[model samples]
Target: MKGVMRFGKKGKLSPRFIGPFDILERMGTLAYRVAFPSNLTEFHNVFHLSMMQKYMSNPSHVLNYEPLQLTPHLSFEEKPTQIRDMQEKRLRNKVIQMVKVKCMNHSKEEATWETATEMRSRYPELFGTF
Candidate 1:
């Protein structure tokens, strides 16, 4: 049997899948989580990268409920400058640090993903408050 197709208002993408990272584009996260709940750190990495990719586009409206921005290109075509390269490098470093702090590490790098999950599970009053 064929199934019926549904769409969002005014031809916009489905809102059921929109979010801080346009979860539609990231359909793999839930599957990964189900497959490997222990790999929360890997999932965290994926989520952070998705978010950074979204922000790198610098969309005009985060609330648009649509994937409206194109991924930013690091280069145009021909010429390259040392200053531009350094700036790009710095931006990448900043993204890594943000992911490490906010999503993955949360402070201590030596802490394995298992340890982090244990902390979250154990200290339901502290980190679990989120």
Candidate 2:
């Protein structure tokens, strides 16, 4: 199986853990077979012990978990909840427009600055009239 790619950025800022997958069986010393959801069936089930983590059994955690609606490719779309701020930068003679958007499941620190053109195309509702 190929390595998993980082989301958004390419460095340590990327998420390291994806899930608390169920362990199906122990294979030899350092490897174990894990169960993956139907959407992630393309990925191999066997993984090294180093890659596995013991999920702390907590019923409260499950109760608070917000399960995202995943697409067929096991990815979910992040919808912009609100427009936090708008700014236009004057570079030389050109003006570049940018918008700070607050996305679902993300905090203020995680909110990203995206081009106004892209936001309009992807999420027209966010722009309202302008």
Candidate 3:
């Protein structure tokens, strides 16, 4: 329930629920032993009931299960695919540049706007030859 890092300063984008794993047994009044997928074997199987939610058994909500491709840190990467747009804003003597980046596995509607300097530094390959 608490392993994942809280994104940004406010934890606004952090995931609320991780899984709907099967409960193996009840450890106590407030604790439960749950079974996790083989891919998530690194994490402990036991969890507090407060950290879990009762999954609604809706057949229509089920999707094809694809085993997650995790990094060493147990996180997935969202690679930048292309720069959709670039813009510059001038304020007095300062000029700020921004770019809309399209990421792999994401749609154009989900493209995020980021500072040009940050994009250049983090993913220089996207810009190519400055």
Candidate 4:
């Protein structure tokens, strides 16, 4: 099941279970009428018993993440913050220079490696006069 895809054409990770929905009433032996939150209005309010799990009062939790400082349209662009490291790869014909750049709103370990020329063209301020 490790390589199985379920979300879409290229979706490797998708939430299989998405609820702690309150059970409104039993609809029969196996089905139950559940109450979905306002945000899940597009989904049906009924589900099978096999699809549910008993709610437990556990302190362990994963908090929801929300991006801050978005524009009026509720979106933010990623910007390069700093240059961490530089390297050159020598091939049979020539050498290719690469740079590791840190971007805004991302952790240090999340920084990505980009070609020096590409990074220069994208954010000239990051590598001033060089």
Best-matching candidate per TM-score: 2
Question: What are the runs in model 3 whose C-alpha is more than 4 Å off?
Answer: 1-14, 64-66, 71-95, 98-113, 124-130
Q: What are the RMSD figures for all models against the true structure? A: 22.0, 5.5, 5.8, 8.9
TM-score for each candidate, following the candidate numbering = 0.14, 0.58, 0.54, 0.45
For candidate 1, which ten residues in a row score worst on lDDT? 78-87
State each model's CA lDDT, in order.
0.26, 0.68, 0.69, 0.64
**Residue 121 lDDT in model 1?**
45
Q: Which stretches in model 2 have alpha-carbon errors above 4 Å?
A: 1-17, 53-81, 103-108
Clashing pairs in 1: none
**Which of candidates 2 and 4 reaches a greater lDDT?**
2
Q: Which of 1 and 2 is the better model by TM-score?
A: 2
Ranking by TM-score: 2, 3, 4, 1
Predicted candidate 1 versus true structure: per-residue lDDT over 35-73, tens digit per residue: 222212132323333323334555575554333221133
Output the lDDT of residue 43, model 1.
Answer: 29
lDDT of 4 at 45: 76
Judge candidate 3 against the unseen true structure and give its global Cα lDDT, from 0 to 1: 0.69
lDDT order, best first, reads: 3, 2, 4, 1
Question: Looking at model 4, which ten-residue stretch has the lowest summed lDDT?
Answer: 3-12
Clashes (backbone N, CA, C under 3 Å), per candidate, total 0, 0, 0, 0
Q: Any residue pairs clashing in model 2, and if so which?
A: none
